[model samples]
Target: MIKEANTTFPIHPLIKSRWSPRVFADTPVSDEAIYTLFEAARWAASSMNEQPWRFIYAKRESDAYKIILKHLAEFNQQWVKNAPVIILTAYKEKFNSGKENFHALHDLGLAMGNLSLQAQSMGLAVHHMAGLDWKKLQEIFNVQEGFHITTAVAVGYYGGDPSVLPEDLEESERAPRKRLPLNTLACEGKWIEQ
Candidate 1:
């Protein structure tokens, strides 16, 4: 069920093909593939090489998976429950020198981008979700003082019945992918309101 993006300009096939899907097959992603995804993330460029991104991942049926699922917003839990893998992402608030790293979130985004592309290349789907209890996760995991929980992700092989989703979600699942035009997104030398 590949919903390849209908791009106005040519782009990398992987970029064009990647889209977050709520529906995921029950097939489990292999351990090696999971590690490979992280390996791709590990190489993402970071601010001052701080590499603040940190991830805690769990396969379906694991105790950690249940704990994560329990914290997700009800809406997310409804769909995410079918995913074979779940991951929590966090970033360090400060560098080793105790200085604030304001770009930590941006760096974490870069890492996630790398991971998503890798997953796409391997015929896997990645869905990032912000609807979670991050503060609770921080306490539950006993994360270090400077580390802040950011987002959660669902990963698994694509191909699940959209009919299983709620009416609104099922419509969304089957709808054509859409994005803002490039002109609205990028501007030349200066900022111009579209």
Candidate 2:
């Protein structure tokens, strides 16, 4: 089920096709493909080359998988249960100078952006979620004080039947993708009213 983006400006087919779908197929992404996704993320541009991004991922049926699932909000768990892989993305909260790394979350977003595009190119689907227990996740993974879990990603093929989803979500899953206009999204120098 492809829900291509409705973009105002021309964009790469990959960008148009990349979207976070709630339904995932019960298929296992190959080890090599998974490695390639992370490789793409590893090469994302970082702040001062800090490369603070870190990931903890587990394949389906792994003991760690169950634990990760528990940290997701009940709503996420409903659809994520079918994902073949669940990944936790984290990053350092501060730099070595004890100053806050304002770009930490931005860097994580770049990494995930690379991962998402790569997944789409490989005919895979990736759904990133923020509805997670970040605090409990830190405890579960033994993440240190300097590191913070920022997001969770569910990756797999898109094959789930929307009929099984609750009516509200089913409607959402089938809705046309929407995005802000380019002029509203970006401007020349000063901010312009939409």
Candidate 3:
């Protein structure tokens, strides 16, 4: 079963099960699920419909897996390498609007959000890492200079074994974290001071 079935997102019940964990079993991910996840991300909203997000991934048994794994921060590398897939999420700098803006990063974020939710629906876990080594990933994937990586996503079946994950990560994997109160995160009514 997935965690926090009642997610804040408007996603369906199945998708809400998706959660992130550093430790994943060596089990492989099916090609069908990978295709479907990207397909869902393809339909995510983008600035001016630019759809700037792009994904590059390596399956667990592939040689590219090692290269991608090396790009992860030491903290993440400790466990993410055990997963079945290592994915680099990126975005093209240029948009359909003929402008070079930072909106692509935001667009990429939305795409990842869609992917995470979709993976959960399929009984999968996607551990995303923003603290990875961007410079190494760019070189490892042979990405062009203009385009840049946004995050690294580790996808696989959750293996709740405490031995595989660091003590801190293991604690998180065991239970759901609390969210900030709506009153703290959400703003209400007029912007003017009372």
**Candidate 3, 1-194: lDDT as tens digits:** 34654546576665555567776666789899899999989988998888888889889888888888877788888888778888888889986565796788888888888888788777678888897888887886789877888888889876646566678877777776566654565577745333
Task: For each of the candidates, give the backbone clash count.
Answer: 0, 0, 2
lDDT of 2 at 171: 93
Model 2, position 56, has a per-residue lDDT of: 92
lDDT (C-alpha) at residue 185 in model 3? 57
Query: Sort by TM-score, best first: what order?
Result: 1, 2, 3
Candidate 1 deviates by what RMSD?
0.9
The residue pairs that clash in candidate 2, if any, are: none
lDDT on C-alpha atoms for all candidate structures: 0.94, 0.89, 0.79
38 Cα displacement, candidate 3 (Å): 0.6
> Local error of candidate 3 at 53, Å?
0.6
Q: Stretches of candidate 1 above 4 Å error?
A: none
Q: Estimate, for each residue in 58-175, the C-alpha lDDT of model 2 and write its tens digit.
A: 9998998899998899999988887899999999988878889999889989999999999999889999999999999999789989999988999998777888788988899999
Give the higher-TM-score candidate: 2 or 3.
2
Against the true structure, candidate 1 reaches a TM-score of 0.97
